[model samples]
Target: MSLIRHAETSAPNIFHGAESDVGLSEWGHKQAGLLADHLASRGAEAVYCSALRRAVASATPIAHALGQSPVVIPELHERKIGPLSGRTRDEGWGVYEESKRRWIAGEVEFSHPGGESFADIDRRVRPILDDLSKRHKGGRFLVVVHGIVIRVALTSLLADRTPADFDAIAIDFASINDLVHDGSRWRAEALNLVVAPSPARPVA
Candidate 1:
C-alpha cells in the first residue's frame, strides 16, 4: 500500500481542518502531475483519497493517468481544527502546539473546541483501514490524504496505542510513503518521497 500526502494546499500553512475547502496551489498542480507520473510508473491497482478538495484534486490526475477513478473516503480526512479553522499561522500554531503538549501528557480528551480528540481519530480511521484491508488484501493501492492522518495511521500500526502525536513526524507535500498489509499486520517501506519539492518557508 502507498500513502501519499496531498500536494501543497492553497492554504499551505494554516491549520486547515475538515471543513477547509482549500484546493491545490499552482505549484501544487504541477506536483499533482509529478505524483501522477510517479504512480503511473508504479502501476497502482486503485487510487483512493480523502474527501477534501485538495486531496481529490491531488488524486484525480493520478487516477486519470492510471485509468482508474479516484475513490473518496471521508474517513481519511485530516484532524479537524474546529474553532481554529482560519486563524493566522502563529495563532493557530500556538493553539496547536499547546494541544499537542496536553495530548502527549495523556490528556486524551483534550481538543480544540468542536474538534476531534485523538481517540476520535482512531475510532474513525480504524474502520477505513479494516475495510481497505479486506477489499485490497495484499494489493498495492494509493491513498492520497493529509499529513496528520498518515502520521496517526503509521503510529497506530506501530502499536503506539495513543490517540494523538501531533509532532509525530514531518511528511512533506506530494510525498509517498510505502506500506504493506498482509491481511493482519502492516508495515511501511519507504517514506518522504519528495516528488516535487516546494519553496522553502521564509525565516520567521
Candidate 2:
C-alpha cells in the first residue's frame, strides 16, 4: 500500500493539526491533479483517506482516476496539536518540536498540553492499517493522509527504524511512502518520494 501525505494546505505555515479542518491551497489543487495523473498507472484498487478536508481533497482526484470513491477514516487524521492548533511554528513556542523530541527519546506518553501522545496516535492508526493490509492482501491500495501520520507509521512499523528517527524523516506534501505487507510484517519500499514538482514555499 502507498501512504501519501496530503497536498499543500491553504495555510501551509499554520498548525492545522487534527482540529483545524482546512482545505488545499491553489497550488495544492494543481499538485493534487498531478498526483492523480502520476498514480493513474499504479493500478490501485481502492483509495482511503483521513476524514479531514485536506486529505479528502487530496484523495478526490486520485479516486476519480481509479474509478473509486475514497473511504474516509477518522483514525487516519493528523496528530492533534491541541493548544498549538492554528498557530505558526514560531508562535507555538516550539512545543510541538519538543514533544516530538521526547517521543523520539522513548517517551511515548509525552504530549503537548492537551495534545495526543505518540502512543495515542499509534493506538488509533496502526490497527486500521493492519486491517487494510489484510483485506487487500495481494492488491495495491492508496491512503491519502498527513505528514505526521506518515512519519509516525514509518517509525512504528518498520523494524530497522524507531521513533528516534522521526524528526529526521521528512514527509513532503503529496509525497508517497510505499509499504508492503508480507502476510506478517510491514516493510518500506520507498519513502518521501515526490512525484511532481512542489510549490516554492515550505510545507506545513
Candidate 3:
C-alpha cells in the first residue's frame, strides 16, 4: 500500500494541525496534478483518502488517471486536533511538540478531551487495514491522509519501542509513504518522500 499526504494547503504553515475543511492553494493544485502523473503508472487498484477537501482534491486526479473513483474514509481523517486548530504557528507547534513528547514515551492513549485520541485512531485504523488486506490481498492501493494519522499508524505498527521513536517520522506536504503487506505483516518501505518540487518555503 502507498500512503500520500495531500498537496500544499492555502495556509502552509508548520504545525497547522486539525485544520477544518479547506481546499488546496494554487500551487497545491499543481502538486496534485504532478502527484497524479507520478502515480499514474503505479497501477493502483483503488484510491482512498480522508473525507476532507484537500485530500479529495489530491486524490481526484490520481483517481481519474486510474479510471477509478476515490473512496472517502472518515476514519482516515487527521486526528481531531481540538484546541490546536487555528492557533498561531508558535502556539500550535508548542502543543504538537508536547503531544509528541507523550507519544514518544509510548503514551499512545493520550489525546485532547472531546477530540480524537491516538489510541482511538489506532482503533479506527486497524479495521480498515484488515479489510484492505482481506479484500485487496497483494493488490497495490493508495491512501491519501494526514501527517498525524500516518505517524500514529506507524507507531501502532511498532512492537515495543522506547521514547523518542515515533517522533522520528517526518511527513511533508505531497510526500509519499510506502507500505507493503507480504501476506503476513505490513512493513514500511519508505516514509515522507516528496514527488514534486515544492515551492519556496516560508519560514516557520
Candidate 4:
C-alpha cells in the first residue's frame, strides 16, 4: 500500500499567480520549514509537488531532508481559474458561486468565461495519479498542491464523490490529508490535519 496526502502550501501572498511564482511569503517560508521538520519526523519519502513555485518551494525543505529533490509534476498544478486566477477570493464572488452551483449540479463540462471546470482538471490529474499509484506501490508519498486541485483530485480518486463533495472538503494552509492505495483500492487515511503551531513561532 502507498500512502499519499494532499498538503496545501502555506501562505503565498494572496493570489499573485504567475507574478508571485518566485517563492513564499515570510509566513509561508516558516510554514514550509515546519512542514519539512514534521515530515522528516514522520520519515516520508518520494515527495511530489506542483511545478508552480509556491508548491515547489514548500516541498523543497522536506525533500532535502529526505535526500531527494521534490519531483516537479505539472499535472498536479492548480485548477486554471482563468479570469479568476489573479483575483482575490473576495473579488471573485459571483463567478465562484455560479461555478459552485454548476459543479454541484453535476455539469462537469461547465467552465467559466475562459477557465476550466472540475471535469477538465479531473481528466488531467487522473492519469498522473494512476501512474503514481502503480510506480510507488507500498510506499509513502507527500503531495503538495493547491486547494481546489487537491479537492478535485481527491473526489476523482474516491468512488461516488462529485463536485458537491468539493464544497465540503476544506484544505487549509499547511494542512495534511492522508490516503492509502492498497494495490486493490484507495482508502482515506486522514483528512484536513491542522498542525499545532510550534511554540517557537507564535502564529500572528
Cα lDDT of model 3 overall?
0.78
Best candidate according to TM-score: 2
- Where model 3 places Cα greater than 4 Å from the true spot, the runs are 14-19, 158-164, 200-204
lDDT of 2 by residue, 1-204 (tens): 999999989989889889999999988988998889899988798999999999999999999998889999988999988889989968985788788889889998899788988889889899998899889889999999998888888999987789899888889999999998786778899999997656644334
Q: What TM-score goes with each of the models? A: 0.89, 0.95, 0.89, 0.85
Residue 69 in model 1: lDDT: 92
- Estimate candidate 4's RMSD in Å: 3.3
What would the per-residue lDDT of candidate 4 be over residues 1-204, giving only the tens digit for each residue? 222233332433244332335456566667777777777877665888888887887788878988889888877777776676666667876787787788878887787777778888889877887887777777677788777777777777866566778788877667777888765666677776756332235655
Q: Any idea what lDDT model 4 has?
A: 0.69
Clashing pairs in 2: none
* Most accurate candidate by lDDT: 2
Query: Which candidate order results from sorting by TM-score in descending order?
Result: 2, 1, 3, 4
Sliding window of 10 residues with minimal summed lDDT for model 1: 158-167
Q: For candidate 2, report its TM-score.
A: 0.95
* Model 1, span 1-204: residue lDDT tens: 788999998777777888787988888988888779878978878899988899999999999999999999987888888888877788778788776787778776778788887667867886887787678886878889988777767766644335455466568999898887655677667777887788533221
lDDT of each: 0.80, 0.89, 0.78, 0.69
**What is the Cα-based TM-score of model 4?**
0.85
* Model 3 per-residue lDDT tens digits across residues 48-140: 998888899999999998999999987778777777776668767766766677777777777655466677777888679678757788788
lDDT of 3 at 181: 71
